[model samples]
Target: MVDRLFRMKTKSIFVRLPLLFIFFDAVRCDYFPTLYPRESETREIKELNGLWNFRADMSVNRSQGFEEKWFMSRLEKTGPVIPMPVPSSYNDVTQDKSLRDFTGWVWYDKEFFCHYHGKDRGSYTGTVYWMITTNSEEAKVQVEVVDADSNTVVMGEGIKGQASVSNVKLWWPYSMVKTGAAYMYVLKVTVKDSTSASTDIYRQPFGFRTVNKTNTQLLINNKPFYCHGVAKHEDYDLRGKGLDMVSVAKDFNILKWLGVNCFRTSHYPYAEEIMDQADQQGIVVIDESPAIGLLQQVYNLTKALDPTRLVTFASSNSNPLSDHVMNIVDVVMVNIYFGWYQDTGYLQTIPYQVPPTLEGLYKHYNKPVMVSEYGAETLTGLHTSPSFTFSEEYQKDLLIQYHQEYDKLRHEYLAGEMIWNFADFLIDQKTNWAYGCNKGLFTRHRQPKMAAFTVRERYQKMINETQKYQN
Candidate 1:
């Protein structure tokens, strides 16, 4: 396990939510439905996405605590309880504004009833399906959906076998079923640490969807299509997950108006409501992991070439091992900050490969891997020397560098790319790097920067310059 030192960044977004237990207000908005219809695929899903239990473990308690049997046993005896909510960060339970620091290990659990009325039109196999997910390489945990209301346990099984084992029954997008029927599916996630355990269980809705990527393309129902999608943020001005349905619904309306055929959840996963609206709108999703803002220092590649590193698959699919369970491209959103920061030579790290690693993640996960959000930050740092300045010469070179790099993978592995941003939004303004100019194809309001026109012309040309094959 890579040990990432947990330190709250001086300016982080987690600090937005207020730490307080306010009375649960009463304003009834319909809960997001988890199921829809797909003519050639499965439908009907239950979304287990409501209140869930949560807890975070400090690192010190884990690494050193793992060696002591008594200490480990003591933690297992009483699982830690953090907070409970649906589809938000685990820090929802604490006052630690920066959920980044609470990263060691966390847990979530919930309970529900099961109901799989009967197989659909064909291949009617009578069997129950259970699915679980976590961050640990290998986890030992059990989930039980018991009906204490009726004094009976419906589904109670420990999940600790392998990655494929967990993929027993996968959900495909617009193919198999739109949703999974859960009369009541409760969840209990126990992310075990050496001497500390974080467990969260609660009632929420969960519907399964299977996604597949193939033939340098992607399909929702075995149909080839181009996904004109955007990586969206929660709400431009809302604080925390403090979004209202009216706002979410409005975004959906905007998407429909814009003629978007797909939606990628950017770097992080999103709330259940967002997924429901997308499915309903027939918008395909690249559904990326919860990662963004690659503002970091770069390191030099060790001169010694290690074959192991060369052959490892770079599937950024939050769950590297869940390959069998869900189709997700492990995309590396290469930005100037994420890797090889200061090293001007690091740009040569293209065609990065790890042996026969799925040839490419899109093929492996049956999904197109996108450079969803990437571009040289216009203002990573200012001109240091007398002649150094943020000039068109510098910008042209920087833009052309990444464009040329990804261009090689065009017919090879990559699906497409979305520049760091379309326009400088509210978030960029908050960053220290913002000095009127930063990451954006357009200015803050909506004016296209010179680079914007370049992106349009280059991208449109790529679209028009497709090579046709003859057998």
Candidate 2:
């Protein structure tokens, strides 16, 4: 785990909210902030990850919170005040059993720093950017940034958009610029819209980075791409899928140590802070939606934000929608567990399954195919003489089978290949040994198994070989 010694150079800037009385109307406005950084310009950012005042309306009986302008400031009259953490779901925070299940209108408020240098404010624009990873269609969210004197500064209505600010710094990701530090500004988000009866607000660190894809390569900052990485889940023992900064930081450190260049938010999208860190650390991300229900409309909605990035409908099992999903996406990706689960053949047969799948998809679609997932489950510390199921030896061999073939094929039709899992994760109790999916190269606690070394050795070799093309 990484030590907590890495302090952010940027300090928190406290700004007070203003009581701006806007005319309330029955008609709802659906406009989102579309202003953001241009290709040549990087914008300033402010992280709102600390404590915030929270209130949850469980019974769906709350209009006073909005009428009284609760988002403008902390509402002292509304029940007991709960200190909620931003960039996390409110479902898993409180000890009160009712609060954990309570999911009506939740509001969050925090103060952050922004450079509002009175008059010299040039053409620079500041934006309040955040993502609503998981939410109901009925869930209405709004973000408002206010000045210290309680005047509304900038606000965004929907999931993503930018409010224009004339004076702010640019957010530079780590390793992208050697001389500059990551500078961020302050902003606020409010869910209780004066025009709506619902409120669901969220806050987190925000930044921007450039990502693009070619016929057979993914590029970040115009660098020749090779993603020697793994797919990850947000699962932890107690937090379950809730955002935990310590856990996120530790996982990032592990990625750095493992020489991983990228990762996919397997199964679902990650918290805003994690994505923000990925931008800061120069780690590429393949943000995915939930499994099985691969909706193209939602994927299109996300991809609309940045056309440069590639979006894939992550289809795991043999879904009939695979062909339809692959047609719309920029890349063809499918999760195959051929030799492990169903196609129970020897490791040699793995090559037959992988290449043919990619070739068939490419022949039809003429798009780059990527192996999004492929792995065999193996118990930690378990081994066998000749190699068998649930044995570490078998796990290592299975990964080798996939990697050796992927290395050979990447030059032609393959784009990138991400292993099924980076670490063992807790699932339901019905799962085999350890009460979780044990296909990870690392144990749940992040202990490296034999498969970790197998991939590490392979990845290091792949990294070295790919560097030649980078020149």
Candidate 3:
């Protein structure tokens, strides 16, 4: 059976499809590529991705004081419980979608004291680090920083304040060159009870890499590199969209096989392992903040916070109606995201989000920005085909207009924009006018919806024509 499968895949019709399947299959799940030299660094990483014990409380106010140096001293012995994962969120893995939907206060506690030792029996100087994420603090309170940065936190309050760490190894991404299979890293998170009679603690295995965007371009160690890549969503087979670690691994392997050097996670940030693999393979990545624009209808107070300036993220080959639709939508997306900027009084006053969003992203792990996903889908061009959208006489005039607007902003401000999607995807929802049109540069099933070659040609020209090196 295996021999027959190999023969079929070897045929031209099967072509890259079989390799694609294998690549994605391997990267998506926890498995090896059968043969290849291993990296010692890869084995060094201890992945802490799994079900973590959890508890959620909406009424109890979590301590914001944890932000201070004197925060980690608190500890509690009992609570109503559930399951969560380190490097994960309550928004995922919840059986009751309703509980997952509402973001209040979520508390997770896991007991893991590192089994792997560096040197001494129990005297080695180590640290406990955490990646703390909170839903929305407006309704509740939580801490959101990797716990290692919060070492030796002293308690200012009772045991109500708590943080967690798990024992795990560093993760591997398809970073650069011959990345060793083993990772040279460690992570620790410990909360001490100076006020209590005992040493109350929680620990985890972890490591850190600094990501910062610099100059006019993005860089990891100190070099500029463009993203050769694609965007990814969490859907395949039957596991659905939950943050399954095995699935993420399979997907990573797929990208590696495609010779993809970079990827922008559409809509929201992806699993921690995704980034870890990027680190291993030197794959450039844009870990975006979660998508909140679509939540417009979910919240009543959204429109009032149209704080960021939407300077028209138009396309170069945009059509008119599409332009108008995009002009309106960019304003909405800006409103939702920049609302935080406005609330903090940092909108136009500082080139903060624009420069630093790129810079900050590149700073930790150097990689160029795709600005990856942006723009909207136009319903006006449903009749037009893909290649013809930019054929000089396309029915869709608005598509070009959007790119034109987007191009004007290019320079040091943004690197490259993959522009939302190459095609539409299935969401099983009525939100996309019977299809998720807003996401497609092309349509579902790989059809060149009305914005295909138009985008590709223009972007290619921009790359070919511009001597960006002169700057």
Per-model clash counts, in order, read 54, 12, 98
TM-score of each model, in listed order: 0.35, 0.58, 0.35
Which of 2 and 3 is ahead in TM-score? 2
The Cα local distance difference test for each model comes to 0.40, 0.63, 0.38
Using lDDT as the measure, the top candidate is: 2
lDDT for each residue of candidate 1 in 330-410, tens digit (9 for 90 to 100):
233222222123443343442242212324444455444455554444543334332122433344455566667656655
Best by TM-score: 2
Model 3 lDDT tens row, 174-213 = 2332322123342322333334322223333333322334
Error of 1 at 33 (Å): 36
User: Better model by lDDT, 2 or 3?
Assistant: 2
lDDT for position 333 in model 1: 29
Tell me which of candidates 1 and 3 scores higher on lDDT.
1
